[model samples]
Target: MTRLDFELQFARGDFLLAATARIEAGVTGICGPSGAGKSTLLALLAGLLKPQSGHLHFDGDTLIDVRAGHFVPPWQRHFGLVFQDGQLFPHLSVRDNLLYGYKRLSPAQRRFELQAVVELLEIGALLARRPAQLSGGERQRVALGRALLYSPRLLLLDEPLSSLDERLKQQILPFLLRVKTETAIPMVYVSHAQAEVDYLADRVLTMADGQLQPSLATRDAASGLARGSAGL
Candidate 1:
């Protein structure tokens, strides 16, 4: 099993974050309420934020070592991020957005193809449309496609379904399931909703008030909920 070991400490204003975690392959679900440090954790993992003193090792490769003065940039880290809002470029067509990351790959480093990604996310019909023209689910699907096209080693999802309605969430759930089963790439899914974590995660981590803990005791908290009530 691939593993990510982290011991991080960071502070901003009056808030402080002190978290230690070991993430493994498959989905590692992060559950917490709105004010929790869930997003802060993701930002650290994605290299968007640097910890004052910390260590991060993924599969034995050191990504960050504060003592050693080492840090990898987000692009070089090969992490794909999908926010609640798709964040697709308003000026680009869906096809362009999906192909954007694919084009960034070196000629010899190509792993994921555009056609395969399009098919995987079922976004073939929305290729020519712009971001403003697509529905919420459609935009998210395109965002997912674009991220996959980057062929990231890890996928980071921060409430990807939070902005969608019930019907849209239902429509996108199958694709998310496919993302888990069909790809070997690991994922860190961050959401406040326990049901969503239950349906998708292999391991659970709970965050609260800038702290993180393994949810070993409450592992089934979300699993006990009905699928419809879980809301994806």
Candidate 2:
């Protein structure tokens, strides 16, 4: 299994984040209350924020080493990010938005095809529309498709369902499960909702005051939850 090993420290004004983790394949959930530095940790892993000290490695490849002055940029990391707001290009049509990163990759690097992703997300009918034309759930689906089209090494989700209503959350959860079981892309899902994490993650870890707590749930429990939530 692919493993992401890190000992990272970063300070932003009064907030200092220090976290160490060994994330293996499958979904590793980070659950905490707001301001617990969950998103901060995801940012560091995604290369959006640089750690002040220590190092990060992915499958034995050094991605960051502050002492060595080595850092990989966000784009170079090939990690797909899906934020709560589904930051799609306002001016681009759904098709264009999904194709943006996909078209940039050479044919040999394209692991997912456009049709398959569109079908997977059930967004084929909305391709001609722009971001402004879609509902919240639709927008998030397009954003997810855009990421999957890039065939990222890891998928980082920062409360992607937080902005949606309960109904929408239910709608999106099944799709997320499909992504997990179908694509087999490793994921780091950060959410404040314990139920959400418990339902989706193979391993769930709690965070508080910028520190990673012990594992809260096992893979068997999560799988049981998934099996029970089939109607979702």
Candidate 3:
């Protein structure tokens, strides 16, 4: 019974994430238009950015309680983030990058094994290669591997495929589906692509102009209604 509850408020330049959400041990999608604060919410959860007024918690662990002026360290939180660009260490071999987090965990808690994840993401052949040798899709696969290696309490994926070409997206998306099916790790997949949301989300949250909107028929369909000239 994993749980996460968060409320955050902040502004960077012109974007803001005045949003709240709850995740109950399953995949949840965060969908929104560009500049709607989707990534901002993820940053808050990961403790990479703190809010002006808010609190974050996971199963009562107290990740952030700004009211008490307490903030937990990001690394200690075990938040696994996979960004759109797939930020792998350019200098390290794929194997080293994946093993980095594994080495940090005590023997008892390490759940992700290299052979399993490497096979799952089809990265066995890329292990010896540096970042410069792989395609965009392959790089993202390695990023996913690194995140899984951490054994995260929650996975924060910020529009991971947004930067890939359509051809590469085809190659990578099935692997993501495989990831979702094979791992119990709860994920917050951020995307503006309704198609991706439709295929991957168990639940969806839609954001626009820093505010979250609810949809009885799902956001992609509801958004269609809001955009149509026809009266509801």
Candidate 4:
């Protein structure tokens, strides 16, 4: 099982984050308005942003230790993150981009098979295409595929659907559902829309003013979505 144990306090310009959270194996949704520190939280967990006082651990591995002057770097943390913008390399083909980070893994440690990924993401047809040639949804899918191929212990999705229109979002939601159902890794999804949370069938963690609240108190399996469909 994956674990996230983090407590962070840091400031940048007018923004400050005093956030702590624990995530287990499954999708954990973080929903809040733009300034609620959604992306910041993800950055901290990814080791891109260091907290003045906090400890971050995944499973039994210590990712960050402030007291000992220790902070394992981002690449070593085994985190795969999808930024709001699809950060695929324009110079590389889809296949190459997906396999870019895969070379770091020893052959025995490569849990995700390449053919399985191509079939699951249906990226085979587009493998030869460059990033600049892809549609918004396609680029996002490629980005997702790339991150997944990296064999991350935990995945962080920062507003994966933020740039897409409603139709595009609808088109892509199923991919996310497939990710949730098929993969065993825990996902930390950051979003501004509650509807997206429900549509993807994730456990919701609402954020406000740079703090994460207790997880949602519902078990209907459809509670988060029911509220989303009603425009909550």
Model 4 over residues 1-232: C-alpha lDDT tens digits?
A: 3377776777888877777665666778888899889898899988898888878788988888898888999988889999888899999999899898787888876879778878887878998999989999999988998888898888899999899989989988888888878887788888998888766634677777876775463233353331211112
Cα displacement (angstroms), candidate 2, residue 218, comes to 3.8
The weakest ten consecutive residues by lDDT in model 3 span 223-232
Rank candidates, lDDT, best first: 2, 1, 3, 4
Compared with the true structure, what per-residue lDDT tens digits does model 2 show for residues 1-232?
Answer: 4378888888999998888777778888888999999999999999999999989899888999999999999988889999889999998999999999898888998999999999999999999999999999999999899999999989999999999999999999999999999999999899999989988888877788888765536464544321111111
Each prediction's RMSD to truth: 5.5, 5.6, 5.0, 4.8
- 10 residues in a row with least lDDT, candidate 1: 223-232
**Ten contiguous residues minimizing lDDT sum, candidate 4:** 223-232
Against the true structure, what is each candidate's TM-score?
Answer: 0.91, 0.93, 0.90, 0.90
Q: How many backbone clashes does candidate 3 have?
A: 0
Question: Which candidate gets the maximum lDDT versus the true structure?
Answer: 2
lDDT tens per residue, model 3, 1-232: 4388776787777666577665666567778889888888888889998888888889889988888999998889998999999999989999998888888999888888999999899899999999889888999999999999988878899999999998998888898888888888888888998778768777677778887654343544532322211122
- Whole-model Cα lDDT of every candidate shown, in order: 0.84, 0.87, 0.81, 0.80
| lDDT preference between candidates 2 and 4, better one | 2
- Model 1 lDDT at residue 72: 94
Give the winner by lDDT: 1 or 2. Answer: 2
By summed lDDT, the worst window of 10 consecutive residues in model 2 runs over 223-232
The alpha-carbon root-mean-square deviation between model 1 and the true structure, to one decimal in Å, is 5.5
> Per-residue lDDT for 15 in model 2?
92
The clash numbers for all candidates, in the given order, read 0, 0, 0, 0
